[model samples]
Target: MDSYDIIIVGGGPGGLTAGIYAGRQGTKNLILDKDLAGGIGREVPEMENYPGYENISGLKLTEIMKTQAEKNTEIHEFENVLNIEKNDDGFTVKTDKNEYLTKTVILATGSSHSHLNVPGEEEFLGRGVSYCATCDGLFFQSRDIIMVGGGNSALQEAIYLKNLGCNVTIVHRRDEFRAQKHLQNMVKAEGISVIYNATVEEIKGDMIVESVVLKDTKTEELSEMKTDGVFISVGYIPHTELAVQLGVNLDETGHIIVDKEQKTNVEYVYAIGDVCVGLKQWVVACGEGAVAATSAYHDIKQG
Candidate 1:
């Protein structure tokens, strides 16, 4: 197996940023990822939070990051990672196509969006079902849409939808929302309807998402509600299976636990970005990638 000083997994903002830092430091590195880097941000239609750009498309941002990473670091695209095994000298990363041995590894694999497993949810994925509010909110302009979740993101997206002239209805399984007090109050005062203690049992439609079946969490009563589209705002789960198999420590939330240096519990192993147990965001992931790559450089050079 070919060996490199550092190998970064994921290829998103975190992975790309890590590659940049490592390449600048004159370290040989490789970036292995399955999809467009930048994680979920790639789907975001407009990104205003990231500095340097006023308003940018998520796909464009991903391309820019990918170009920078590819020019500086060797990248393996569209490779499905299967497992990671640690050896006496270093670690081995196994994928569908090839295997690589590296002295230091960075886990930048981000999280996956939580989506409904209903019939229409899968069949009509791009037709009606959406996950990113900033991405597909414009498609349902002035139309009625239903959001499923009670977290901060759900309320935030609900308000965003309402601002875009779409009638918003929030369906949550819990009677009380887990969102912040300020947002909860703001959405309520803004005329957003709340359907509490109800869960979506099925998403039904032939061409698009025509409606959803809601079952009461407490009373078990069922009702069919017609809507133009459905947004699943549930939380995310980390992409941490390979890390775990390699004896990396992952928290209860399925996120790899890392320190300020982005080093995991295992030696010569580091994890950065949303896959790690911390706030999940593009900016944060980029910062963590820098830290992990720098730390690995220092540690590897010292040894």
Candidate 2:
């Protein structure tokens, strides 16, 4: 089995950042990702909130980070980590392709998109319903679509769809948007229709998505709306299965519980990014990654 000073379990911005810092600390580390290195951040069409550039795609930003990280540490993509077992010295990480032993482990396994959990949601997943606009926006061009959510991601995708010549309508359960003021403003500026105090009761379609059943939160009245497709951007649910396997503590919401230094309840183990409780932002994840790496280095050096 290959061994490393540190092993990061996700290659998103957080894990990549950790690898960079670990390398700088002169620790032999490796990053393992199940899919592409960027995770869901790459699905973002455009990100305006991240520091540095005025406007940049999430793919581009994470790509830059990935490049820098590769220079520092070894990153293996398409490696699905199946389990982590604590040992006397550290931990044994078992993946589909290989096994690795590390003195410390940093779990940066981000989050996945939350599903609507309504009828037809699963049945018509690719036929009409999608969680990533950048991935499926082109197919809906010039078609009418409904965006479900009130967050920044929802509004951003709504704008992207609108720009793609799709007549976009935002169906949010809240009266007001939860997105940033700038994003809300852009939504209005783009003339995207919004249905407030409403939620998707069901996604109805035959071979493909044809319409949706919407329920009003205030009045409890259900109505049907016509649309070619439904894009769900509600939010993300943190990926904490690995944390659970390691007996790491989690909050009420199931996010990994980490201290100020990003240390988990288990010794020689830490977590960062969406898997940890905090503002689920790229910048925040990057910062936590640095902290976790430094903490791991200090602990390893002390012993």
Candidate 3:
């Protein structure tokens, strides 16, 4: 058994930021992640909005943060936390490799991409349907692909696919995009076709994706479009299963509920970033991480 003043779950921007602050504050801290520290940030093709860098690759930005965080804290990778239980003192964190007792636990687990839940979508996951354009776009050069969603992720990934010599079509349930205006303009300028007010009803393919059945959101009409690939980028849902199992309060959407100080209902436990109630943004997550660390530092100091 190992013990620490703080144990942060997750290794994304939020978790790394919390680690840096907590470690710098003289708190004995450790960061545990199921995989590498980068999380989804690593999969992003480009990030133009992060402060201090006009533009940076998501992987590079994550590496910078991870380097900084590791300087003051121990990072345990490839350790998936299986369960968390409340104790008289604090909490017992059970991971695949070890158990950790901590005075404070910050849940920065972030989120996972939401699935389209359409038939053949799951059947063709590795064949011709994907969520990451950066990872799968190269496999589809010169092919027609359908990109789902109208958010920043969808728009950004569509631009990436367009650059890869693929004919890209963006399908959205709303007529207007939820992405930034600049991104919308960029998508149009890139000549990507947009199918507005539509939803993907089903994906059709035998061994691979060949077409998608779409429904008009406003009209009760259905149509089919043939494509070589399908990229579903609707959005993400917070990874809050551990928090939920431990009796932590959550919002209606399953996001961990946290106070301004990032403290959860359970004492000494905190939540931050996309797992909490707020706009999901990298900068916001970093800021919340800082706040959560400071809050933990104070709580531990007072004790």
Question: Residue by residue across 1-303, what tens digits does model 1's lDDT show?
Answer: 788899898888899999999999999999998875666767655545678998776779888988888878988888877888888778888889999898898988888888767666888688888898878999999898998999877887888788888989999999999987877998978999999999998888888889999999998999999998898889888888888788888788778888889999999999988788877667788899899999999999997
Query: Candidates' TM-scores?
Result: 0.83, 0.98, 0.97
Residue 162 lDDT (model 3): 95
Query: Per-residue CA lDDT of candidate 2, range 1-303, in tens?
Result: 899999999999899999999999999999999999999999888988788988898889988999999988999999999999999878999999999999999999999999999999999999999999999999998899999999989999899889988899999999999999999999989999999999999999889999999999999999999999999999999999999999999999999999999999999999999999989888999999999999999999997
Residue pairs clashing in model 3 are: none
Kindly report which residue stretches of model 1 are placed more than 4 angstroms away from their true locations once superposed: 45-57, 117-120, 123-127, 132-143, 155-167, 174-197, 216-220
Q: Which has the higher lDDT value, candidate number 1 or candidate number 3? A: 3
Candidate 2 lDDT (Cα, 0 to 1): 0.94
Clashing pairs in 2: none
Off by over 4 Å in 2: none
**For residues 1-303, could you state the per-residue lDDT of candidate 3 as single tens digits?**
888999999999899999999999998999999999978878788878888988787888998999899898999999999998889778899999999999889999989899989889889998999988888999999999999999999999999899999999999999899999989999989999999999999999887888899999999699999999999899898899899887899888888988899999988999988888999888999999999999999998897
Q: Rate the local accuracy (lDDT) of all candidates.
A: 0.86, 0.94, 0.91
Give the top-scoring candidate (TM-score). Answer: 2
Worst 10 residues of 1 by lDDT: 41-50
Which candidate number has the best lDDT?
2
Clash pairs of candidate 1? 12-37, 12-38, 13-38
